[model samples]
Target: MDLQQMRYVVAVAETNSFTRAAERCLVVQSALSHQIARLERELGARLFERTSRRVRLTPAGMAFLPAARQCLDAAERAAAEVAAAVGEVRGRLAVGLIPTVAAADIPGALLGYRRKYPHVRISLRVGASEDLVEQVKQGSLDVAFLGLPPTMRPEGVAAHELARDRLVAVVAPDHPLADEPAVSLRRLSSETFVDFPAGTAGRIQSDLAFSAAGLSRDVAFEVTTADYVTRLVGPGLGVAMLPSAFAPQLTGVVTIEVTDAPTRVEYIIWSRFGHTPAAAAFLKALDIT
Candidate 1:
C-alpha cells in the first residue's frame, strides 16, 4: 500500500512479534499492527498467523517479504542516483569545441582532469563556435569552447573568457613569406590564402582583421579545420591565418605574428544546463574557476 505499510510488514516478518517489531520501527504496537492488517487487506491475503503466545508467517507473508524489502532498496537507489546526477563529480561528460580551443590547451587540461578523476567518462566533439552552441542548447553536449564575435552573445548558455590568443600567419617553412619575423595584413594582401569556410568563427576573425587594415585577403582555398590549414601550408599549398597557439604544434609551418590591432578572444564556453564532474574539473584546471 505505502512505504510505511511495507516497512511494517518487513519488521513483523523479521522480528516475528508485533510488540518487538513496533519497538524496532519506533511506532506504537497498535499502529504497527494496524499497518500490517491494512497491507494484508489491500493484498487480499493473510500475511501472518498469530496465536495468543506465538507469531508466524503465512505462505503469503513469506512470499511478500523479499519483494517488500526489494521495493525499499529500489526506492533508496533512486534517491542516490538523483543525488549523483545533481552534485557528484563522476559520470559521463560529453564536450564540444571550436577548432582552435580543441587544438590548444584544452587537450592538456583534459589530460590533467583524467589523471585527477580517472573514473569519469569523457567524450569530445569538434565544431564551429555557433554549431557547438547549438549542440549544447540541444543537449547533445555538456560543455564547449567558443570564440564569440562582438555581434554574438552566447544565449541560454554560460560562457567564460579563458584566454586571449593573438592571431598569426602560418606558411610552409620554406615559403618566401616564412622568412619574415612578423608580417602585417598589408604584407599578406597579395598572398594566396587558405582560410575557414565563408561563414564560421575563424573566417569572421580573418574578415575583421582584413577589414581593419582596409585590405582584401586573396582566397585560394576554403577549409573547416585549423589543423588542415597547417597540413596544407606544409606543402606550400598557400598561406593560412590562425590562432598563434594552433601554430605551435604544426611542424613544417612557420608562425609569424600578424602586426594587427585586433586579436580573436578564446573562451571556455559551456551549456548552462550543468556540468559532470570530469568536465567541471577540466574547466577548473584551465583556470576557469
Candidate 2:
C-alpha cells in the first residue's frame, strides 16, 4: 500500500520469519505483524502462509516480492541522485565574456581557476557586452565579464566591479600622432575613427569622452571586437580607442594614453539565479573586490 508497507513485506519475505524480519527492520514483532496485516487486508490477498514452526510465501507473495524489491531499489537510487546533485561539487558551467575582456586578460584567470577546480567543466563564449549581459539575464550563461556604465543594472541580475582598464588612442606606428606621449581629443576629433557598435559599453565611453572634450567624432567603421579594432588601426583603416591592457599584445599599433578619457569599470555579472561553485571560484581568481 505504501513504501514502508512494501519494505516490511520484502523484509519478511527475505528473512522468512516474523520475529527475525522485525529485528532486521528495527520494528517490534507485533508492530511488524500489524503493518503486514494492514497491507494484506488492503490487497485482499494472503502474502504468507504461517505455521507454528516457520513462515513460507504464498503464491501471491512469490509474484509480488521481486516487484516490491525493485521499487525500493529505485527509490533509493533516486534519493542518492538528488543528494549528489545538491551536495556534490562537480558539474558543467557556461561562462560568457565580452570580446574586450577575453582579449585583454581572461586566459590566465581561467587557467588558474581550472587548475584549482579540476572537477568543474567550464565553457567560454565571447560576444559584445550587450549580448553577454542578455545571456546572463536569460540564464543561458552562468556568469559573464562585461564593462558596465554607471547606471545600467538590469533587474534580477547582480554585478560586481572586478577591475578597471584605461582607454587610450590607437594608431598605426607611422601616423604622426603615434609619436606623441598623449593625444588630445580635440586633435583627433576630425580623424576617421573605428568605433565600437552602438549600445555597447565601449561606444558609450567613447561618446562620453567626446562630449567631455566638446568634440564631435567622425565614424569610419563600426566593429564588435577590441582585437579587430586594433588590427584595423594598424592598417590605417582608422584611428581607434581601446583598453591599454591590449597594447602589449597588439602588433604594429601604438597606444597613447587619452589625456581626457575616463577609466572604464569592468564587471562580473551573474543572474540572481545563484552562481555555481565553479563560477564563484573563477571570480575569486580575478581577485575582484
Candidate 3:
C-alpha cells in the first residue's frame, strides 16, 4: 500500500529470502515479514510462495514487480528534480560504456564533472554496445557511450552521436599485405580472421561489411575483447577488422585502412524518461545536451 511495503516486496523478490531482504533494507526480519503479509492481505493475493529452501514469486508478485520498480524510480526522480530546482546536483549516476570505444576526451570531461559536482556519485559499467543500450532502456543505466554502425540506431532511447571512426584491417607486420596503404574486403576474404564474438556490435558491423562487399572470411579466432583480437593478430594468428581507435600499438602488428569499410559511430544514449540531476550535470559537463 505504501512505498515502504513496495520496497520490502521488491527486496524480498530479488533476494528470495526474508532475512537477506531485511538485511538489504536495514530493517528487522520480523517487521519486514509483517509488512509484506499486511500488503498481501490488502491486495487479496499471496505475492510470494515461501518454502523451506527458497522463496519464489507468485504470478501476482511477477505482475506487480515492474510497477513497483517504476514507482521507486519515479520517487527518486521526483527527489532529484526538487534538488535540481535548488541548483544542487547530488545523486547516484549509473553510466555504461562500450569497452572498445577510446574517446580520449571522456576522461577530461569526467574530471571536470567531478570538480563541479563532487557530491555526485558515479558508477561506470563496461560492456558491449548492445548490452549497454539494453541497460539504458531498462532503466538500469542512466546513460551510456555506445559504438554502433552508422546504419543502426538504438531504439527507445535518446541518442547523441559523438564521433565516427573508420574500421581498419590489422595484420602482423611480416604479413604480405601489412605494408599496404589500404586493403579491400575481397582480398581478405580468403584469409583467416580474428574477430569479436557474434551478437556484438563490432561483429555485426563486420558481418554487414563483408556481406556488402560480397566477401566471406574464415574467422579463425573469436574473442570478446578488442585487445585480445589485436594480440592474436600481432602473433600472426589471423587478420582482424577493428575500429580505428581500437587498433593496438603492438610491435608486430600493423593497421591498414579498410577500403569501403563501415564507419563505427559512437553515441551517447540516455533513457527517454527525464534525466536525474546528476545525469543532467554530467551531460552538461560533456557539452552533450
Give the range of the ten consecutive residues with the poorest summed lDDT in model 3: 243-252
Clash-forming residue pairs, model 1: none
What digit string (tens of lDDT, one per residue) describes model 3 on residues 1-289? 9999999999999999999999999999999999999999999999999999999899999999999999998887787788888988877788888767765456677777888888777788988899988899898899999888788998889988888898888899899998899988889888999988887887888898889888778987999877788789988989988788777544468989987887888999998877788888888777778
Model 2: how far residue 160 lies from native, Å = 1.2
Better of 1 and 3 by TM-score: 3
At residue 287, candidate 3 shows an lDDT of 77
Best model per TM-score: 3
Find the candidate with the highest lDDT and give its number.
Answer: 3
Across 25-47, the per-residue lDDT of candidate 2 in tens digits comes to: 99999999999999999989999
Whole-model alpha-carbon lDDT for candidate 1: 0.78
Which digits, one per residue and each the tens of the lDDT, describe model 1 over residues 1-289? 9988988888888888999999999999998898888888889999999999888999998999888887875564455456567765556567888777733466776777778766667799989888888877766677888875554567888888766677788889898987888888888888989988888877887788788778887787988887788778889989987777666667778888888734677666676866545556667776666
Candidate 3: C-alpha RMSD to true structure equals: 2.8
Query: Which pairs clash (backbone N, Cα, C closer than 3 Å) in model 2?
Result: none
Give the per-residue Cα lDDT of candidate 3 at 286: 76
Task: List candidate 3 segments past 4 Å from native.
Answer: 104-108, 172-182, 228-237, 248-254
Model 3: residue 56 alpha-carbon error in angstroms: 2.2
* Selected candidate, larger lDDT, 1 vs 3: 3
